[model samples]
Target: MSRLPDAPPPGAILEAAVYVSDLDAAEAFYGELLGLPRLMRVPGRHVFYRVGATILLVFDPEGTTVPTSDPAIPVPPHGARGEGHVCFAATDAEITAIRARLAAAGVEAEADFRWPNGARSLYVRDPSGNSVEFAERALWG
Candidate 1:
């Protein structure tokens, strides 16, 4: 096998995913409610959104678990049916606005927290029960 180059670790994350039970609801929540730009949507399968430079993919577990590609172009089937977590970075002002918007849309925050370092975050569940967090920039940086 060829060895990888001896170099520093990758500098950025290009994509992250959360498997969901309902693709449509996921789209409405992450796409419409959160204001993340909708990059692509494969109905009944997955929805991709632009979160900064990362592609946030919300995939329907059932649709993704089975191979659908033709024999000439094999594609592996991979998926899991369970909740996953992804934390998104947000500023203090943006967090406040997010809380207000969620409230206006009737979605309740599951929890809100202040870290020991003074960073704050709020958690909510998507339609498929995935834990979603919007945290202050300092929390992860």
Candidate 2:
């Protein structure tokens, strides 16, 4: 056995989730356009994307409300449905390539600018209307 704290650490975000009504569109935009690797997919239900060590889970709100197992799993119902935002750390090359890829896919950026800290960001919406951002932190000196 190991001796680690049972409580979660102060600043660790292990995973994030966004509820989407359509899985196909989500997969196409996140997996194909954003190039996030698809970790797994439950047909007509959910899709998981690996963003570095963080897992991005996109689930169909209508289908995901059901309990995980017959015993109910003692988990709260997440049945959330709406637009959410997620940002990924990107390199300068990735920022450029993402812009090109979005253009190729006919997806326009809602906003693009550099923050006061010299971080650059581009915001775009996935097919389900969730805002996705690709950011490069202080990449240009």
- lDDT score of residue 133 within candidate 2: 86
Ten residues in sequence with the least summed lDDT for candidate 2: 68-77
- Residue 15, candidate 1: Cα error in Å is 0.5
Pairs clashing within candidate 2: none
lDDT tens readout by residue for model 2, 41-124: 988778999988799999898877776665646665576768998888888688889888898899998998888887889999
**Top-scoring candidate (lDDT):** 1
Give the backbone clash total of model 1.
Answer: 0
Top TM-score prediction, candidate number: 1
Cα RMSDs, all models: 2.5, 4.9
| Candidate 2 segments exceeding 4 Å error | 1-8, 70-75, 138-141
